[model samples]
Target: MGVHSVNWEPFLTCAVTGAGDTLSKHPDLPVTPEQIATAAIEAAEAGAAIVHIHVREPATGKGCREVAYYREVVERIRDSGVEVLINLTTGMGGDVVVGDRGGEDTPAPGSDFVGAMERLVHVEQLRPDLCSLDCGSLNFDDDRLVYVMPPAYLRPSAARIRELGVKPEMEVFDLGHVAFASRLVAEGLVEPPALFQLCLGISYGAPSTPAAMVAMRDHLPEGAVWSAFGLGRMEMPMVAQAMLLGGNLRVGLEDNLWLRRGVLASNADLVRRAKAIVEDLGGRLASPKEAADRLGLPPA
Candidate 1:
């Protein structure tokens, strides 16, 4: 799918809950396996073609990197009869933080523990139709931690992704990440007609704005299918913005937990609202089959 010269309808994906704070932030956010599966089904019913999942610990709301949890979640979603595509996160394992004054400080809490193979382990085991490969590292989360995905790390991960036959959503926060992703494709680590997700409005990486969105979208490699999202207040607006610009739209509690101020949002609510937004703007939203075709995902 080229960035241009194609008749594009905005394909919506609900990012449900990311691997971040949920117990304190939103009361309705899905934590248990049952909750997660139900939320995903509701999102699919509400017109989200894909559900971007980040599993959590059943007891604590802490994000879990457990493969078993992911397997159970996938099972529940499959048995529930929802036709949406499952896009797992290969992003959680690669976080790195260094302490001040080298070894003197107590190693400022690093999430970057595993290499690409370890990062790709769950995906290889579960084999979701789509999985995210955070193209490069940035200073993610508040209070100094890095979500590191160096190219040396990415090459093997991308290769593993291809080996499993899962579509990799190359998440680019800036133009340089886009360039590096293209390099990955050229190096044959990533396959032709790659898929990308242009993540915007995160702390200390890139601001969510129209001009910046366009500039980054314009920079994607030819024949690549891409999606974009903005955090907080820009979330809904960026949905419409991405549609108008001929890219896909992504939304959910991962980026923001509100349908409006003080109104808690479920994954379904987010998807229903996005469906309405595109419709209001004289654009149509894609069905699961349409989205799968658009992103080269297998038929449902």
Candidate 2:
């Protein structure tokens, strides 16, 4: 396969609702199952071939791992006949918050660490087209908040995802994380044509820059399909950059919450803007079926 060949056709992924603390920040963030499904469908209609989903607690709007929420969201999307691929988030349930400085043994109130099996419950039950497997852990935003994904945890999670006949989208936050994912592929834990999402511009991780993105892209294993995204203002810029680098692009309220300064964005708006940028640059947007074929995914 010509890994570095220019990708004149790009696929867009709209991350409908991320498992972040953005409910209060964005007034229109999709919290309920119905709302989330609507947003996903709208995004697909606006040129998103895939929708990366993360369910939140309907009442409190906090991120949760409730299988019912995922079921409802998936059912609505599938029932709508939108022809979009589903990529569920298995990266939740691994958050760890450090408690008082002196009380190292005690985890903070928000910490919710669980085994791999618990994280995969929705993926196993719903059997989405793809599920994310975070490659490694790091301090999410600051010293107090950390996201944990050790190799021991990832191996079993990857194995289970494979057994379920679902594709695992390895989320790599840094160079080391990419190396670890390569190890998983080398060990045959991750299936061939490994998929990776290069996550950049988050706190304490790789910066969102052209140089950094190219570095990560260069490190990807041969025949591996990769995509990259940056948070906040870097979102649209990275969309073009990732496509120019011969990879796909992602956008939504999950990574960014604004269409412009002082303007809030819905998932559909983000996807539309990204679509416009992709097309304006002489790149064709891939439909759901086209994206699936390129990624070696079965039709939706």
Please write out the lDDT profile of model 2 over residues 45-161, one tens digit for every residue. 999999999999999999999999999999999999889999999988899888776476647888899998999999999999999999999999766888999888988888899
Model 2 scores worst on lDDT over the 10 consecutive residues at 1-10
Enumerate residue pairs that collide in model 2: none
Clashes of 2: 0
Clashing pairs in 1: 95-111, 95-112
TM-score of 2: 0.97
Q: TM-scores across all candidates? A: 0.95, 0.97
lDDT on C-alpha atoms for all candidate structures: 0.84, 0.92
Summing lDDT over every window of 10 consecutive residues in candidate 1, give the lowest-scoring window. 1-10
